[model samples]
Target: MLKMLLLFLIGAAVSIDLIAGQACQPRSANPGRACKKACTHDAQCRGRLKTCQCDNVCGMSCFNPNLACNDPGPFPNGQISPERGYGQVIRYTCNVGYNLRFGNNRTCQSNKQWSGVQPRCDREYWHFFIILFYMGEDL
Candidate 1:
């Protein structure tokens, strides 16, 4: 049992190291690292024309937006489309009993940002109080 537990601990450490090694670990000490995509980031990229990607060895750098768009990550109470690429139309759908407020679909544009605004997955009961409060007005 002791040997098995030790082996498991070593295995877990190895797994963690391997995972972290494969990721884009940021290197801040050396600013002179010459990479093709240098100084690229959502903030560093100017004029909304360039993209801030981290594929370069010098960490996140600015470069022209790629044809394949990156995933927009998580939504609070909604699900975003799985497909991510240029010209691909993504859909935003709210979970059951929730209302999708704003844009439902967005095209992956040339710029890094998605076209138009994303939807807010609002709860069905969320508006009840506001509507009741505004009952006196002609809403």
Candidate 2:
């Protein structure tokens, strides 16, 4: 009985990634309590919390949680919501003479990285109008 109990306890501890057997979830999903364990090193955590470390405490850090991306360009405009943090979402738009050539929205993933292609402002082609004008000239 004693040996069985000890084995169970050890297994339980090892299976959980958080400290004190507490649940570790995203900050947005779990409020008030620390959904993640504080860490003193990178190996102890994964995903957005991978580089977790708080003053070498082994568990207490989430320092660099935000993610950044390069600018899309000029004339066309776009914006990233909560731009400086993890789980951010970006939306893009174009001016009167431009069209969006890529996905309009992207999300910052749990790995502290952005997901989806960066949007581009492509110049619109008025080929239909040109074709119609040529046809009229021929007529």
Candidate 3:
């Protein structure tokens, strides 16, 4: 019984990574609190990639508990939401009157990075047209 218990404890402590060899996962990850405030480091985060960033919308949190992808930081005139980490669906939005040229929301992949070109916020003429239409403008 003692041996079996010991084995279980050890297994629980470390998780295996299939691609990039073995990586250590902090056994006691974000216990008790559910990221009420901003997380400053890896220990504050939970799951595999363990990324922590303070978001304007969600505060310092691992939206994707399985985190990774170095802080992409804020864009020119836009922001990334839900935190940058694995399994998280990253969404981009521009400031008032600005528009996203082409880039779209993409997932923070398992390899600790975003999958494709991060979008940019620009003042495009088309954006005004779209907004006007939504505001009940006919033309």
Candidates ranked by TM-score, best first?
1, 2, 3
Runs in model 3 deviating more than 4 A are 1-65, 125-139
Tens digits of per-residue lDDT for model 3, 1-139: 9999998999665543333344435423433223333454557767665555433223344445544667766688888776665556778889887888667686655445565677888787887688788999555
As for candidate 3, its clashing pairs are 38-60, 69-112
Q: Is candidate 2 or candidate 3 better by TM-score?
A: 2
Q: Judging by TM-score against the true structure, name the best candidate.
A: 1
Give the count of colliding residue pairs in each prediction: 3, 6, 2
Residue 132 of model 3, lDDT score: 80
lDDT for model 2, please.
0.51
What would you estimate as the lDDT of candidate 3? Answer: 0.59
List the lowest-lDDT window of 10 residues for candidate 2: 53-62
Off by over 4 Å in 2: 1-82, 127-139
Once model 1 is optimally superposed onto the true structure by TM-score, how far is the C-alpha of residue 49 displaced, in angstroms? 16
lDDT string for model 2 (9-111, tens) is: 7755433334434433322332322334555456766676355532121224444554454443343443433453454566767766677876777655433
